[model samples]
Target: MPKHLNNQSSSVSLTVAAMGVVYGDIGTSPLYALRECFHESHGLPVTPDNVLGILSMIVWSLVLVVTVKYLLFVMKADNEGEGGMLALLALSQQSRPVDLRKGLNVVVTLGLIGVAFLYSDGIITPAISVLSAVEGLTLTTDVFTPYILPLTVALVALLFMIQRRGSGTIGSIFGPIMLLWFVTMALLGLHSLIQTPEVLRAANPLYAIQFLIRHAGVGILVLGSVFLVLTGA
Candidate 1:
């Protein structure tokens, strides 16, 4: 193969591998996000209108925050080809004049806090993801309920055990698995969508606005749940 062809293949492989590692948290969140919207803690009824409203909120949030804000705008603000809060802070500090050093201390402090939050997410995300996956056993059969915690613990242990092999090896394995996972999710979503074509209307922002208007008191709670969709974004 030509050198350019080899380079192109390498780039594609890396992109798929990156998707495997990066998409896992956000990919699995849908398992609980919609259901949590109607959880008893939220005090929201599971009416059709409420469901549509919640769906609308989720769709619009992904579009606005993930697609527009992060992909389009934030991705362009990378510092030395890196992104995230620390990179943004570095870029900001670099752009500012050295004479304006008074507030730089505050900026550095906030950047450290952001890094702390990132570390917390790294710890919390996998625990929640594993728990959510194992919890699905309960839906299949109550007989599995008692084993859920133990099973989740075992799976998490195995996950960490494999981490010693490093990210490239993990990503190579996870990449194809994630591709299959996404395909399955797409098919399942399509089946449900066929049954309730009306849900497609929830893609419109008007439904979300109306939902908030109709249930102003509980709208805050619903928004909290909807925010879950952006957990790993």
Candidate 2:
């Protein structure tokens, strides 16, 4: 494959440093997503079809949003090296008429607010992931509970310490690690599928639509919780 456009020396350094800081949360997420998905909020083994449907939605969302929409299309719309909602808004404002410009600015400001919230979430995600993982020790034994904070602090400190070296040292390993991670996840999902093949039925959009329409009351109450599933990226 050709090198990324942002592959210059300084750019590469910055990317690695940024990845070192950003990837930990996502890298650790599979530790919980499948587990929680299978363990439904109700005391029933979640229908396998629903699990697969959700996974399918997640897979396609990544393909559409990350690969096609952002990488191929929106990234090409970059102004200089910047690309974000604000950048697009700025570009659009240049050509929009006065009447439309006022409406667009209101929309742009709201988009910017959401972008800022997501950015803040990204910055804090690592600490939250590490903290939650380390806190798991408490599940095994409350006697060890006192050590959780210290352990979390130590792990976070080490994570930050590696940022100085940048991600280059570990960069080579990431692709294989990600491959293994996905393969392992697929295996577990397949096992779940074997246990519950009926889940394959939810692949139809009708199931999701029907479920949402039928359970509007519960869905309304849990909309925020449902959205957390999409929060990792």
Candidate 3:
């Protein structure tokens, strides 16, 4: 009976729990995604259009993927809301025999693949998060240089040390903080939009075509980076 789903099915509870498990994956990324977008991928003298184009794409993708695709479409695709391939396998079996149309085998295989990738992603995400956060310590002192390993160790140690307590208390009281995060992100994007709305001409699929035609390699990289953002929770 987690707060999100009161009196829901055990299957629904399982699905919501899976969603909660991945919150860390999304939280870990906000630290670097945008910086990587404009600085590393788009490159500087980042024109307003470039920023707007990217921002528009990011926003709409969030709407499409998070709002429409996952929360709505994929969730509807859930097997009793437990989700993933394993759940789908169960539904397929209930509907027909395993050998009937190979549905059981196909769904089960895909389900296992999803779980495998997610397991790897779960481990890699936390490591990358701690690594990136600890790197911030380097900015304050050269003395911390020789101790990067130790600093990382200490930071990671502290993060794990708090795990048993859960962050529910902090999350409950810090609703405003979360709001500020979204507000600030929106404001920065609005600022960019105000500067060069025309860059939004890139919103046209033609721009994508031209971008691909002109700078195929960089375009592919930017697209790949954008794909990562779309994959965010």
> Please, what is the whole-model Cα lDDT of each candidate in the order they appear?
0.86, 0.59, 0.60
For candidate 1, what is the TM-score?
0.88
lDDT (Cα, 0-100) at 97 in candidate 1: 39
**For residues 1-233, what per-residue lDDT tens digits would candidate 1 score against the true structure?**
99999999999899878877888678888877888788897788788888889999999999999999998999899998999998888787786533444555767778889889889878877787788888988886899988999998999999999878898988887888888898999999999999989999999899999999998998988898888878889
**Native-to-model Cα distance after best TM-score fit, residue 39 in candidate 1, in Å:** 1.1
lDDT of 1: 0.86
How many clashing residue pairs, candidate 1?
A: 0
Task: Quote the positional error of residue 77 for candidate 3 in Å.
Answer: 2.4
lDDT of 2: 0.59
Candidate 1, superposed: residue stretches over 4 Å from native? 1-9, 96-106
Model 3 CA deviation exceeding 4 Å by range: 1-28, 37-57, 96-104, 133-153, 165-177, 187-206
Candidate 2: list runs displaced more than 4 Å.
1-27, 30-76, 80-82, 85-104, 135-146, 167-176
Among all candidates shown, the one with the greatest lDDT: 1
The TM-score obtained by model 3 is: 0.62
Q: Best TM-score goes to which candidate?
A: 1
Per-candidate count of clashing residue pairs (backbone under 3 Å): 0, 2, 2
Ranking by lDDT: 1, 3, 2
